[model samples]
Target chain A: MTGPRYTPLVAALPATVPFIGPETQERARGRPFAARLGANENVFGPSPRAIEAMAQAAREVWMYGDPENHDLRHALAAHHGVGADNVVVGEGIDGLLGYLVRMLIAPGDAVATSEGAYPTFNFHVAGFGGVLHKVPYKGDHEDPDALITRAAETGAKLIYLANPDNPMGSWHDAATIARMIKAVPEGALLVLDEAYVDLAPAGTAPAITPEDPRVIRMRTFSKGYGMAGARVGYAIGSAPLIEGFNKIRNHFGMSRIAQAGALAALADQAWLAEVQTRVAEARDRIAAIVRANGLAPLPSATNFVTIDCGGDGAFARRVLAELIARDIFVRMPFVAPHDRCIRVSAGRAEDLAAFEAALPAALDAARRSAG
Target chain B: MTGPRYTPLVAALPATVPFIGPETQERARGRPFAARLGANENVFGPSPRAIEAMAQAAREVWMYGDPENHDLRHALAAHHGVGADNVVVGEGIDGLLGYLVRMLIAPGDAVATSEGAYPTFNFHVAGFGGVLHKVPYKGDHEDPDALITRAAETGAKLIYLANPDNPMGSWHDAATIARMIKAVPEGALLVLDEAYVDLAPAGTAPAITPEDPRVIRMRTFSKGYGMAGARVGYAIGSAPLIEGFNKIRNHFGMSRIAQAGALAALADQAWLAEVQTRVAEARDRIAAIVRANGLAPLPSATNFVTIDCGGDGAFARRVLAELIARDIFVRMPFVAPHDRCIRVSAGRAEDLAAFEAALPAALDAARRSAG
Candidate 1:
């Protein structure tokens, strides 16, 4: 018997995952990584208060989480100096991006993003039948001017830009981003993904008003707040744009324990400051290790540092594979130029020590394999 | 400075929530629900082991949940005697339903469901610009025969049926359901929502192989598993249909803590048995309370009992409002005939006592308002 027919768009889409988890790799290898430095997850862990809140909330899982995400939205709005209507909390930045794409992108719609950028956003756009236009990074950073030019040329409905961006770990300051925001085409909305903004240097985030309908900024608890497993993230935008999410999002998707943990994490700013300090130290350690291994470390505003392997994309891939084979999890960019570098996340002292210990052997192995 | 234009379909859709949560009602009423017997939550709560597992997982929130949900899916597969390829886990039944509808229903695709059935399914169909053909319920129960006939007539892509159904707590035997499954029209997939099947009597669920492509069965942790707030659900179907979820679902949407909790809950079958016993006793208790109030109680195989209010829809609406005014949070059906009943969830002894104490006063108030 013939099964149900999938929509033409869905039928044509490939079944693919944007990123593979470390756990999946571990299961395949039949052993866990000695140092988990991939995926840019904060190794410093969440605030004690957030942990306690989640632990306590575990007993109260009999009731569904408040579908409105009332208290978290209010708290986030107050934190950002905007009205509650300006914020919409969701399953995470990944989940929120899916909703945003669904709300705006229909078949044949044009969207734009930087090449080698967050792949999940591109996945969503493609899933909804939107055509994606990619703009290459200038030097090591996302080129805002090129992205805006492409959007204008293509009449893209949405354009995505990640500040303190992934893979390359390079960032444009707030002043530069402010200029880019104004240059966004008249009808195109800029999706400003600031998932790593919390760990970025001061003045790195632009001073955009909440009522600017031209841009929606995304933030998450995964990196700076150290709660990736909680899957809590939010978007800040104009009321109309934010309210539009209510038309299509999964209203009861949030976990009650996560809501409580995120609320507690937002309250404990002191703990966040501690995490920032720890992350900065870890970045310094990673930089030193890369430098000691005779690699060039790029300037970073995020919790991860990208180290140039002094070779082409294939050489960098070999370096990453050697590191993974040596029981240290690391990743590299997918496109050219940036693919010459290996991305390493800031980890705890013990994890950094393991990475430091493994790097020389991994480098030697990569060199031998290349020869 | 105009915002991005929404697709014509999205622009035409109104923003509406399918279920107004009890928390929303409490906020509107400026107080908390004294007895939360409205949402069909299991007052007996989750297993202690599950709570402990979640509490432990709270400390490991620094890492994202496994994108593949490999461990949970394997456990679920083993429990159901199905291969891992035949099962797909998601955020919740509601979330999965949205994804399923998006996969099958393109703009103007036809779908069939009983009128006034699960509104969330309708909401998803409308959000995706699908045309919904609704058939009226036969008596208080969903008529699967009529639904299949309509599916054939309309060439509907999907048809929805909830066994041990919500709002009315009515169900059909497995033998009858097997007949209905055979009659499902060609090219149409039947969505068999078994949300409350865990609380139904033995042999209530139909014996269908996981390889059956004509029907997809949905099960959840929200009812008899007593973990509503965890937001975990799974669907069983043929391997192709199960794998198609990867094309559109949020890969990392499941909370890490919730996954651990659900895994532990599944392992503890004794806890589920105990919950089933408690739920049955509570149902009997609720039926007794309704009889004592001079109302007719429908025979219930689910956690909640639907009581005939011995009046018309308007009179039942008054009773529901009066119950809410008296701080007894309960709900009723939305359509005619069924609207003559007020649905009450089985609760703990104290919560049931509160409901019992408030019923007399609520009835008196409703009668006075009618007069």
Candidate 2:
């Protein structure tokens, strides 16, 4: 019998996942990492109240989660000072990105993003057969002007930008982002992925303009709120745009535990502050460690630091391999110039200490191998 | 500025969600449900061990769930006696169906299902712009023969069937299902949703054909495992079809607590058996209440009972409205014939008692309205 007939797009797509989990690497290594720092997850953990709320909700797991995600959306609306109609809750930023792309992108739709930006966004665009026009990062930060220009040039439907971006914890100032928002071409909508904005400095994210139909800002509970495993994320946009999600989203996709945890987490801003403090401390420590090891740590506004390895991609890959061998789980960028750096997450003291201890030996091994 | 440009498919789609949540209903009525039996969720709840596991996993919410879902997949494979490569886990059957449709159905591709089958499936088909060919249910059951014929005639890429079906609680025997599987037309795949199979009688499910490319069977923790809010469902099919999910699925969509809860729920088979027993008893209790009210209760192999109101769809709709007026959350089928009945979940004794107390008045109100 013939196998399932995949759509031409799917048949041509590669079988590669966006990110491999640290757990998979641990399993393959036959041992867990001494310092789990890959994938940019908040290693500081979630609020105690969030955990308690999830525990309480676990007993009621028999009922389907509110299909409308009623309470969370309202709370988020109040939090963001937007109408409830201006927000939509999703399983996570990843899931939200997928849904958003599906809503705006048909086959051969033009989409644009930085060449080394979030691969997950690219994955979604390609999944929908959207032709991507890539703009390379300028000086390690996402060049907002370049992206807007590319969007206008390509007549793209969606353009993605992450403030305090992944792989390189560089960010654009609020004024720059606001300027970029204003410059979005008539036909294109900007997908401002603020997944790391929670961990960024106060001036990093642009002021909220919920009715600005030109941009939809994505926020998540995964970073500064320290609840990545909860899979709770939201989008803030104009009412009509937000309502469009109802036409397609898996309305019952959010777990009850996620809703409760995120609700509790949102209520505990003090806990978020605490996480921010911890993350800031961890970032400084990571930067110091990188400097001590003779690598240049890039200025970071998010929960991680990207260390310029002072070498090419091949040299950085060797360093990465050596670090993995030394049980220090870390990642680097995918494209050139940016790939010259290794990205490290802001882990707790002991976790960072493991990375600190392993780095010198890893560097030595990489150097020896290069020679 | 013009609002976000929606794909033509999304723009053409209605804002109607597949199901309006009970929570939304509660909010609209300004009161909580007295007995929430509308959604067919297991009121008996998840296994204690599953709750315990979720509670434990809550502390680790800072980390993303494993993208590969290795441990859970291995366990599911072991449970089903299938190779791990034959299984694909998802947020829920709803989310999986969306991904599956996106993978196999380009715009205007043909898909077939019974008219008034699962609306969420229809929602996904429309979301992907799949042209659907529908056949009428025969005697309140999904007619497999007609569905296959339609698929053959339409050259549909996907055909859907649900055993121990939703809304009407009707089912075909295992032998009939096997015969139907063999009848699936060339270039078409059968989506056999067994969402409620754990509550169905033994010998109701066909024997495993893990390598068979023509049929993909969906199973969930939402029913007998009593974890609907956990949002975990898996598909078992040929290795290639299962792997195709990697192309477009939210790879890290599953929550860590969800993975943990489902794994624990699966291990405690005794709890599943216990839930099955409770569901059977509750079904009988519901049937008795229906008979006492002079309504006709359909035979059910699933967790809910559908009672014919002895009138047309409008009469059943009035009964539904009256029940809602009394704070009893229940549902009715959206299609004719089946729409002549109101479906109620197999709630616990106390929940059923609330329904029993409310049903007489509800019936009286409906009759008065009908008159």
Candidate 3:
């Protein structure tokens, strides 16, 4: 309390974490969860090649990573069918989003996001002192039209939207999203986050022209590639937008081992395809578990399924708590309406088995606790 | 640019890199540098045990690092003889400095530093729109008294100092620094960057308690520990100061492999001592090389030698270019006085041998070119 004072923005901010890690929850509960099916992490793990690359590159961690991120960017460009100038690799999509907000938003500037879209994004905007204007989700999905309208109304300089969204597991098809991008008001940049695009059906992602400067697309090795811990993410846009990152990014931020692992992850299309299939199967299994528990599961294009608890947010919160108490790690949305649903990530068969066995007793316990 | 327009701050920033890496320079030159002495990277590499631990942990890259950084922080606290609450691990000293600047500096807020202090610190201050007030170095060393006076005069929120300083490689003893700390004006936070402290002699570092609230001490594995690519650094201060970072930090930004690597790096004190000895030897060798070429080498407590070219900044610039032409990578200070000398890092025997062979030739070339 006697420390030299913080700047006004930092002093005014509450010491809040964007998400409670499952580890913290487990420690508080005095035991590890039987089913680690929260946080949307890929329980299936990374590709064998990626793991081997990381292991091999680990020996060379003594040498600082290439500050330029030259090799990874080149490899990513070839894999994605774009020029190297179109890509900028970073710690993760979360880290990249932080930098983007820092670059584009100043104090009191308006930024637009969907309500309950991604708390992490909102956290970044708040961190940079931007005024966040959230558009409510329309029918359990990110409403691009609403976001565009809000951006226009607020004169927002930045807008964030995640296709194949989290929590609600909703998406907009390519043409619909493309139209939305075209409709973005002047001076507004659309941050189209496609973190879950690999798990989505064909045409779920817009055909973004890398030459187009109006929108930047973000992707990661965290989801379908199953290397979340590797912390490799990239943003793709026009040369100018990509170049701007050089002005302020941690020059040597990328880890050599991570760059190597992500390069292998990008090169292995077969592994990604297999991961997508496994993710789809796990999603269906989770849906089946929800049905067995007499709850409805939303159709999902991502690695997680959102189950309606058949009541308000309070009931969903109780269910989440009961699941945690029963050694099942899961989460619920934060906003009302969406908060009525509990989210479960795809995990291994054993983890799913644990979830399936725990659901009934957990639900009953939640009901008793609520009463 | 037809792209989404950037905010005025971002648009005003030139797309610039702080330094062109040796690799990039080599590529442009169409040949590798015979002596890799620039950028201050440890050519001696990291502890073999640390490398082994990193490689071992690479298999577990599927799991995100402990966001609490519990194990690493506790280990660092024990190593530094402080409580865990006093330490906060981050990407690097560079990264932590960015957060510190963001926390204490607002647009148009004044900050003070030595005229030729670490450019990265100045970069961070400028990035946040802080007005930089520099105190010139007295006798090629950072003048703490002058810096304190400048801070008081300008009502600066933050002041930066690098002990066992960079560029000119000068240092102040611990007692002098403690005295300077006591003299610091009220409301100004002194940032002591001790990145090179491990390579310096005993008693060269101030003995301020880690719980001291007025000063934030930064340390890194990027220097003597030889894990620059790992991107691991930490700051020691009061609990409140440490907690302030939780307000806006990238919660999941750290790499699993990096944490494991840095943890191992910190645990190996024997390896650190050995590296310290080796760095000292290399510094002596570099000084010998400079002496052989008839240039004066400044006494340094850091891991590099600053060799006076015995002329003006223009002459030193010519010498640097001549060395670059001769495929020896080295750098010079960006500001006057200090810029009159060229900095060369301590490296392996082979790297020093390369420097030995090229120096005479480079000097001759520089003289001819100047004429």
Candidate 4:
């Protein structure tokens, strides 16, 4: 019997996930990964103070979180020198992206992004029935010029750019991004995803004023703050755009414990500094390991290092599969040219040692499989 | 100075919150609420096991929660004697409702619900640009037959009914609900929100099978489990309908700590039983208090009691405002007839004591102001 009918757009969309989580793989393989570095999660963990705050808040879960996300929003506003009205906190950047797309994109609207950028963003665009125009990467990094050109050509309403781009771990400096922001076509909102900016080198974030209505900057506690599972992310934009989120967002969606943890995490700058330093060390170790294994590690400004596999997309896939099979979780790019490399996140010394040990065998297995 | 343009529907929609949280009122009044009975939160709190589980999961927040929500979904399936595919969990019932509406309601699609049922449900339908047909409540209860008739007349894509309804603590029996389910119009889905069913009397819940494609039941950890702040809710329905959530849901949205807490909370059925008992006792106390103040307390089968103010909506409005001014947070229904009552949630003894202490003064203030 026929059940309720899905909306035309929803009916046309595929039932797919952007990324198969490492846990799903672990379940399928009947074992946990030896070194969990694939998803780029910060293994150093959130600040001890943040964990303590969450534990304390656990006993208070009977009450729904502040619908306004009052304290956290004010703190973030003060941190960024923006008014609280200029900041909007959500379940995550992914959730915010969905809301943003729904707010702007009617069916058949145009959106633009790099060919193989964050799939979750593309997923949102598609979910909202936005027609996506994909621009190719220039060398190892997303080409802002090409993306802007494509947006102008297609009359795209939104242009998504992730600073310190994922998959390749490449970044554009602040001045470069500032120039790109200037070049953005009129009427197109620039969505600057700064999920990795906390792990990027200085000057990676442009000094855009919060009242600039042309761009919305997304930041998350998921990466450098080491609270991905806490699912807290905020967007900084003009007051009108930020206020628009309240129209359609699940206003009471934030988890109370997550809010408390994020507040504490934001307050603990010393812990963040320590984690950054450790991440740097881990990156160096990962690079050395990759070089020793006959792969060239790409220059990275984020928590993960992308290494050129010295082959094509198929070869990189095989390498990734080999690593997964060897109990060393890793991932690679999704499109051509960029897929010639595999991405590995910075981890603890023991985790890196496990990765180091598994790399050679994984490479051997991949080579054997290719032959 | 123009920003990105919003879709026509979003442009037309007002940025409004359905409920003004007690916290926002506290901020405005510069004082905390003396007794929080406005929102139907279980002040008794979650199970000790849930708190411990959340605390334990706090340290693991660095990792993203499983995209599949495998363990929790499977556990819920086993608990309900349904297959895992019959269940889909989300950020909360609010989040899930948004997704469900988006999935089913195209712009201009017809939806049906009681005029002042759950405003949040109405909010979602409006957010999705659905045309909503409102039927008046039959007496104090949601008229299932009227809702069904309206759904058929309007060819509604979805019909929403909350068993053990909110704002007015009234409910219909299982046999009536079963008849309503059978009478749901073809191509229309019935959304059964059971947020308070855990506290309802035995035989109140209809014995609907999970495989029933015509209806989807929403359940949450926010009420009986005392985890409103945790933000976990699930929908149980036919596998096909449940699988549709994967097409548009924020796959990585669930909070890790919340997931762990809900799992532990579900396992501790003893805790749920005790909560039900406490809530029933609290409801009785609230009714006694209401009757003592020369108001009529409606018979309740939920966690709150709606007390008729023995006047008009205007009088009830004054009573509600007086309670708020007195730092006793209580809410009233939004429509006529029903609006002649104030809804107070079941709270701890101390909280209720504060409500009892303030009610006479609030009534006095209302009477004097009306004069």
Best by lDDT: 4
Off by over 4 Å in 3: A1-3, B1-5
Ranking by lDDT: 4, 1, 2, 3
Report how far residue B282 has shifted in candidate 3, in Å. Answer: 1.4
Candidate 1 per-residue C-alpha lDDT over B33-128 given as tens digits, one digit per residue, 9 for 90 to 100: 899999899988899999999999999999999989899999999998999999888988999999999999999899999987888889999999
DockQ of 2: 0.87
Native A-B contacts reproduced, model 1: 0.87
Sort by DockQ, top down from the best: 4, 1, 2, 3
Docking class of 3: medium
lDDT of 3 by residue, B53-171 (tens): 88777777767777877789999999888888889888889889988898998878999998888988888887877899999999899999999999989988898999989988889
Per-prediction TM-score: 0.99, 0.99, 0.97, 0.99
In the order shown, the chain A TM-scores of the predictions are: 0.99, 0.99, 0.98, 0.99
Off by over 4 Å in 4: none
Q: Which residue segments of model 2 deviate by more than 4 Å?
A: none
| Candidate 3 residue lDDT tens string, A108-206 | 999999889899999989988899999899989999999999999998988999999987999989999999889888888999999999899999998
Candidate 1 chain A weakest lDDT stretch, 10 residues: A206-215
In candidate 2, list every pair of residues with a backbone clash.
none
